[model samples]
Target: MAAEDPSVSGVSGRYATALFELARDERSIDAVKADLDQFEAMLADSADLKRLVRSPVFSADTQLKALAAVLEQAGITGISANFLKVVTANRRLFAVTGVIRAFRALVAKFKGEATADVTVAETLSDKNLDVLKAALKSVTGKDVALNVKVDRSIIGGLVVKLGSRMVDSSLRTKLNSIKHAMKEAG
Candidate 1:
């Protein structure tokens, strides 16, 4: 409903803001969000699709054609499909994931919601995820959406990033701190 803030700089942010505005005007925000989520999952699941988006060897025309087919196959249409096609035509396909993330952030902000990037040593069960989301919601006083990631290197515990604030409670960080303290004591 509002014009994209000029402060939202960078190619991805600008493009995402434009797309978000367009989707809002068209009353397709939810549909576009679903499409973007599906596309993001595809990117994460398929090495070839990730390469296609990131590689510079593909010409704009080739990218457009391939992406169109992929979108169609995925049943993504309407404003989301058009916006993605425009991104490909403009030679900004490599930044699609960033754009989608920016768009989601805008949507969440518009909805008066908060998002937390939660990294855990292992994939969380649905029940655990619900409990975490509820806890975050209580803390933020807003509906909290989680962007969950699994990092086995953490060994255990969770790392949560909410807005500019981060809570690093991972075993790795604790061990590193202890090691540093031991060295200082020695």
Candidate 2:
């Protein structure tokens, strides 16, 4: 695992950096992270929320009103809620997910931690997950946080991405290699 560069300079990155700095200064990093996580989960679980965030059909006022209601229902408040309202008002709601991800990356870098995006063919057991985490920690020599995703298209095995590095051990890749080798041999 490796930490992402803290100097991300895109629009989303700038917004995330500002929010991250604000959270740090206000001593609400954990609270803001939790709020963002909850909102991200909501975005994932509700098609309507996803549409509201991404679709440009809704005016800024409409988006702000709907987002405020959603945030209230989700129990989000304080700086996090106000920050979201500002984003909505600015018509940047569509990039909220990217902003959240960039913020998480910045926080992890600030904390001297690394995040590994691990894709597996199926969900791992808790025991397996622990072993994987241990391995990543050993390799990175830093606290490694796992962002696990399950994609059966991999057929089997796992793929791990840490910053600029990636290790692909998926069965699909192995089979493709074999197929290519056979073609060369023939």
Candidate 3:
């Protein structure tokens, strides 16, 4: 199944597949997923952590030490911590984000859930998130997991990408369409 997904191909896919299998064998899929999600969130939130993961300047020892501290502080343990340390030791930390994403895809596939990438003008309230999930579930006929991103450039409304299909309803896009239509009229 990983071979069928373009996003889950190559090195990241390989690591993610191995991690997923290990998690399954241990029956700790949810715990591993949560830990990976927390790590990914930290990567997104911390420039220093991102630099540590992505920069070639950091020696394996340095990265390992820093990562150990971070994981311990974040309360990440078990398979997730071991997997991360192994990846760091292998010097593949630069691709950790892709690995995490591929792992998420594999988990979604295993759980029969559809993952949607959603871009909104601002952070959504929990109520709005639940509503969106319900709507997506109704359409996909499966439990829907949302990966929401806030992009102020969208101006308003939201954009949803489910598999190969994308629906863009942002104010920026609507205004651009109106501008194009008016130009064609002239």
Candidate 4:
């Protein structure tokens, strides 16, 4: 089980670190992770919700109260909702979405999960995903948890990104690289 240091970076890192510590203290790491995932999904699906959180024009009170209602109706815990209110009151709601993502990454780190963001041209089959996971585990020397994505512009093959590193086997990239090489040779 590889454990990452509490040390991450930027404003997002600070918010995530605080929330992660609280979750760890309450031994509700799993539940908090789930709640954050749900929050991310809601933010992604609702344009108005995204705007409300990111827009400075909305009063802190509006954000605080509206978010509280949503969290309460969703059966989220007091601490989670309280955190949102604090972010709102401080006018840090714009960081909320990134905080949730970073919190999940940190939680995964503490849980010994190797998170990889994988992008491909088409939706992958479970079998392909399993194979990819296995191959990634071998390469990374840790269990790999994938976040799959699609980019039709990939043309073919897949582009797997892990943190600052990437494996670009995409046909588009390959073609471009070849074209560059041919022009340079000529």
Candidate 5:
């Protein structure tokens, strides 16, 4: 199944499982997670890195050499450093982000924590953030660690998302509803 699978469907999970097993065997799960976090940050912060990873023209040798320099500059560990080199040598760098996320999910499972991505129109105060965290914990029955994002473009109110379900109560959404209602009434 691993050999014949198309990554378009369930790539991250597969790669994460493989990496997670390796980390578990080496007793470096925490270190690996931290390393992957750094790698993910690099992927986000460097457009050139993303472009380089996605570029098909770079031979595996060139990619591996470049990745080695990047790993050294970033102070990456032996496990993570070697993993990146292997990925580059095999031309699997494009899946770096997914692998990071998937590895995080695995780490969270091991830590007995749940990950919730929360986006709001504005930054919530720490007090409000705690309230939100408590509410989510009450519902999820697990320790929730939120990934918060602020988007001022949303105008007002909040959007709470837990997995696939979304509770959209933003001012933008309310205004759109009011507009739709007026048009229907007219």
Candidate 6:
């Protein structure tokens, strides 16, 4: 399952694989995925949660206590909640984001869908998202699930990573290339 994407490797991959197997066996793949998505969204939205997840200053016990509250508040119980608690107890809470991403990749593959990591200067509208999905679908011949991230540093345009291929059309890259060319000419 981890053969194609190198993102699913080492510590994160192993944990993700174990969670994936459990979700698959229990036939709660959708429930676990939704819970993980909620957790990821919370991590993105809350600075304190982000710190709790990424900072090693917090001991395992503190992280566990904090994570328990978070899971309960988010109503993310069952296998997904257990998985998070296990990760925290193992002192691998720092890599939870990667594990979630890897788990999403596994689910996407299992469903015969291709997952694309897309970065844009701003959030794309629903219409634009549907158009991009259609375009990617045409290319990959599979339904594409987009993981969209916003980075203002891109200035404009977007960058897409599909499997081993990446298309970087961001304004930052374009400007950098032009600057490099002028330097070479000078």
Candidate achieving the largest TM-score: 3
Task: Report lDDT (CA) for all predictions.
Answer: 0.89, 0.90, 0.96, 0.82, 0.79, 0.95
Under the 3 Å rule for N, CA and C atoms, how many clashes does model 6 have?
A: 0
lDDT of 2 by residue, 1-186 (tens): 112464455778888988998999999988999999899989988999999999999999999999999999999999999999999999999999888888888778888889889999998999999999899999999988777788999999999999889999999999999999999999
- How far off is residue 41 in model 3, in Å? 0.9
Q: Which candidate is the best by lDDT?
A: 3
Residue pairs in candidate 2 whose N, alpha carbon or C atoms collide under 3 angstroms: none
Better of 2 and 3 by lDDT: 3
lDDT, candidate 1, residue 71? 95
The lDDT of model 2 is: 0.90
Per-candidate clash tally: 0, 0, 0, 0, 0, 0
Of 5 and 6, which scores higher on lDDT? 6
Residue-level lDDT of model 3, residues 1-186, one tens digit each, is: 779878788999999999999999999999999999999999989999999999999999999999999999999999999999999999999999999999999999999999999999999999999999999999999999888888999999999999999999999999999999999999
Clashing pairs in 1: none
* RMSD, candidate 2, Å: 2.9
- 31 Cα displacement, candidate 5 (Å): 2.0
Tell me the tens digit of each residue's lDDT in model 1 across 1-186.
Answer: 224533245888889889988888888888899999999999988999999999999999999999999999999998889999999999999999889878888888888889888999999999999999899988999998788888999999999999889999999999999999999999
What digit string (tens of lDDT, one per residue) describes model 6 on residues 36-82?
99999999999999999999999999999999998999899999999
Tell me each candidate's TM-score: 0.91, 0.89, 0.96, 0.80, 0.78, 0.93
- Ten-residue segment with the worst summed lDDT in candidate 2? 1-10
Better of 1 and 2 by TM-score: 1
| lDDT (Cα, tens digit) per residue for candidate 5, span 1-186 | 233323212666677778878898999998998898878778767988888888998888988888888889999968888877877777787787777777766776777777777778887999999998899889889988766667787798888876666878888999999999999999
